[model samples]
Target: MVTDEDKVFKALADASRRQLLDKLRKKNGLTLGELCADHAMSRQAVTKHLVLLEAANLVVTVKQGREKLHYLNPVPINEIYMCWIGQFEQKRLQALHNLKQSLKENDHEQ
Candidate 1:
């Protein structure tokens, strides 16, 4: 069965989509025209990518007086991090913290 997480991963798998997400991250709310302004992709291509992003729940849209503004929704990404990546990183983070403390102690003693 295809899951919500699956959708997010699939949407993020494309470089274009990821770039679109990056653009949205830099500027939270942008209209289609604004997003398409400096892109190599055509308007139709951008629209298709936006559709995938919306399906993944990674992008959301709001209509404001005729213009549709696209915004990045970070909840799904955070959830994925917390559920998957964060758990694995906990040990590595602790190791890094320990290493930092050791380095600091060694420097102070010397």
Candidate 2:
């Protein structure tokens, strides 16, 4: 099965592709021309990056008349955060809380 992590990792594998995602995240929906303007690469290069992102389901394109507008699909990224960072954050917060309590106890002993 193609998991959410698989999609996220694939989408993030290329620097240009990640930059494209960042651009879409900021703008939400943008035309191809607007996305191309931010990069030194050719329009073709940007299109290629968009294709990979589309394959990963990280981006979705819609026809807005003659122009195809691209939008970031954030579900996969949210899944990654929930599965990965969410767990780590809980553990980190617990550890920090424990340390704070330990420090308070040490102060009490002094």
TM-score of each: 0.77, 0.72
* Worst window of 10 by summed lDDT in candidate 2: 1-10
lDDT tens per residue, model 1, 1-53: 32478899999999999999999999989999999999999999999999999
Ten-residue segment with the worst summed lDDT in candidate 1? Answer: 1-10
The parts of candidate 2 lying over 4 Å away from their true place are 1-4, 87-110
Q: What lDDT score is found at residue 59 in candidate 1? A: 94
Residue pairs of candidate 2 with colliding backbone atoms? none
lDDT of 2 by residue, 1-110 (tens): 44546756877988989888889878888999999995899999898888878878899899988999999998888887787678758888889989999999999999
TM-score top scorer: 1
Q: Model 1 Cα displacement at 50 (Å)?
A: 0.2
Candidates in order have lDDT scores of 0.92, 0.85
* CA error at residue 13 for candidate 2, angstroms: 1.4
